[model samples]
Target: MDHNHQDPSTGLLTKEFAEGLGQFMAFASNQETTLQMGKMYCPCPICQNRRFGTVRGVWKHLYSRGFMAGYKVWYSHGETDLMVNFGSISQQNNLDEVGEQQGGVDEHIGNVQMVEDRFRVEEPKFEAQIFFDMLDAAKTPLYDGCRDGISPMSSATRMMSIKTDYNLSEDCVDAIADFVKDILPEDNLSPATYYEIHVSGLGLPYQMIDVCIDNCMIYWRRDVVRTSCRFCGKPRFQETRGKSKIPYKIMWYLPITDRLKRLYQSKHTAEAMRWHGEHESNREISHPSDAKAWKHFQSMYPSFAFERRNVYLGLSSDGFNLFGRHRRQYSLWPVIVTPYNLPPSLCMKREFLFLTILVPGPEHPKRSLDVFLQPLIYELKMLWDYGVEVYDIASKENFMMRAVLMWTINDFPAYGMLSG
Candidate 1:
């Protein structure tokens, strides 16, 4: 008969269909919270120090605190398994610490430095595979449709691919090495300027984001020459032009105006006033007129709104060109930056971290590396807010990885300092 018919309001269906639909809705609504409950038992030192007697207790505590409350839960078997592995490692480390403290003879005073050193010796390396697993677990099933051994695209991979394609060269393998040599800060090749590179172009842009330069060496050198984009397939070398020379700098200013507009639009005038009051009372303001000046700026720039978007930097040996315009492959460097010092309310909080990489372009009478690197200034500001201590740059090329590791550890003074 005519089974497709349905009521307008309820959209009437057969009893079986209605029941099935109800089941689906319930599953969808509770999915995230349910999955969060399953994998909330993290064994990190931060969680372990909470005096939870067991792993299960930690999980329960996280749930009670609503750590993942209202967050959409995405499940990945690999991620859950990885979390378990990390938790086990953390637990073992904790046990080791207890053993060290208890076994010491001679009524010993607890050496804080020794304890700190032991912890660093035990800390797990941040593996890309683990990160990929985390991202997978965080993504929903509907979006995780790839086959076995394949996971979803990441922000890192996508940016790298875009950058690679924009600067495609048959000699990219060789070019990157030369590029690294040219950007070396001084000739010391210290760890401060280490970097890495990756190339991919087969997937969706955003999903392909991944770090190419994990760690590489940087050395001191002043005479290195930048190369033009050979991917453009033209004999003429072209340099990056205009505001494009520093895309990051132009985008940085946009967020400031954008934040002010949002504050005005949300009618957070009283909160704004309170912030000013707090600023004055706390002496957070550099000058007495700073508060008034801020309010005035907000009032005048009511339409100011910063659109947070990804900024990709691609250099063509030929010149910068959009992806579809060229037939030949070019090497592209996708530089991603977040607007600096965004209001706390607009930040990702726990996961917000910023990184910047500098790639020198071929020197030409027309373009300057000074202009090229200017955009990164704003990115540096954002990184500061996130307490980023380490920078992985590849310019002068030695000890890049070690420097990054040191920075990651020492930069957050609250966590303790990194030693050479």
Candidate 2:
């Protein structure tokens, strides 16, 4: 069961490798033509199967570079995940139990599963090629003499940061990309578009719930088929030339379960999600978990609090002026939720903040704002009453994960609206 084939102290191969290599090659050879290119995936310590090699080249690597540690399952080599019991292995190496994983999920997940194949890809053509392509791009340096941290990953992400800071249009991305292209070599990206690169694993589900023109009740749940708002009796649909009835107003809603599970999908974020329980702290209020509110809630609901993985979240919303002070024609209201489970340093980060609902307006819906929150409250109730099954990459198992809205944060006037 011990898959550590190389002795870390000496950087030498263990005796077990000599006997195991034959069996390993036999398995790889059988699956190679079907799952990979002509060359088999090299399991050498240096390449770590991130590089492919000819059978002979791979054998040479195995001899010289050494075998990577804890790869007993061979999931990368087209082995079925069900073949080996990963749960048992993960239990033996839980983040709480191991000294090796102290740094966080990113560093820990690299050893377990890298980006491209982090989640399982079933198609062969999809799996074999993408595994190496993304891995290469992720590791590639933007330019020579660049620091290890300042590479393509950093370069492109910085470009993304610029776009976000300015709230630039999609049209502007091409201009920025062209400038970077003139500088660095053509990276392993599709000329088709960079949407795939920008949002690879970040695609979450959303809904376009119909809203009344007067912003009374959202046409949701049992009211979806209704032609008018229940409270105000305002028309739900607008007249059209054809038979189609377009909604007078629409509210954008993003679901939370997938977003929560996605936190556990990444190697680093998964571990960070558990920081509320694991991080060392003092009596002086550092994280929300250390505060009186969290302790008081825990005292009342010990059963819910006992499960550290059950997420607690903060929902916050505020109105932003979309136009200049001279032309204050529009405002945008975004309802964002942040997990209380991450350590103080990460839980409140902009990247960790998820926008679950978008309310558009010529004016803020001061009184009717709660009507827009109907979908979110309904979903949160479902999450609390009946937990959802989520896969934990760090633990390598499925667990019933529940979430509760710990509190709401807003400006004074906005608080009056939400509080009422």
Give the top-scoring candidate (TM-score). Answer: 2
Per-model clash counts, in order, read: 54, 3
List runs of model 2 lying over 4 Å from the truth.
1-201
lDDT of each: 0.28, 0.68
- The worst-scoring run of ten residues by lDDT in candidate 1 lies at 397-406
| Candidate 1 structure quality by residue, lDDT tens digits, 155-274 | 224435654778655355445545644664345221111122232222211211111121111111221121222233222222466543211111111122222222222232313312
Residue 2: error of model 2 in Å?
A: 22
Q: After superposition, how far is residue 109 of candidate 1 from its true place, in Å?
A: 74
**CA lDDT of 376 in candidate 2?**
89
Candidate 2: clashing pairs of residues: 105-267, 105-268, 106-268
The stretch of ten residues in a row with the least summed lDDT in candidate 2 is 99-108
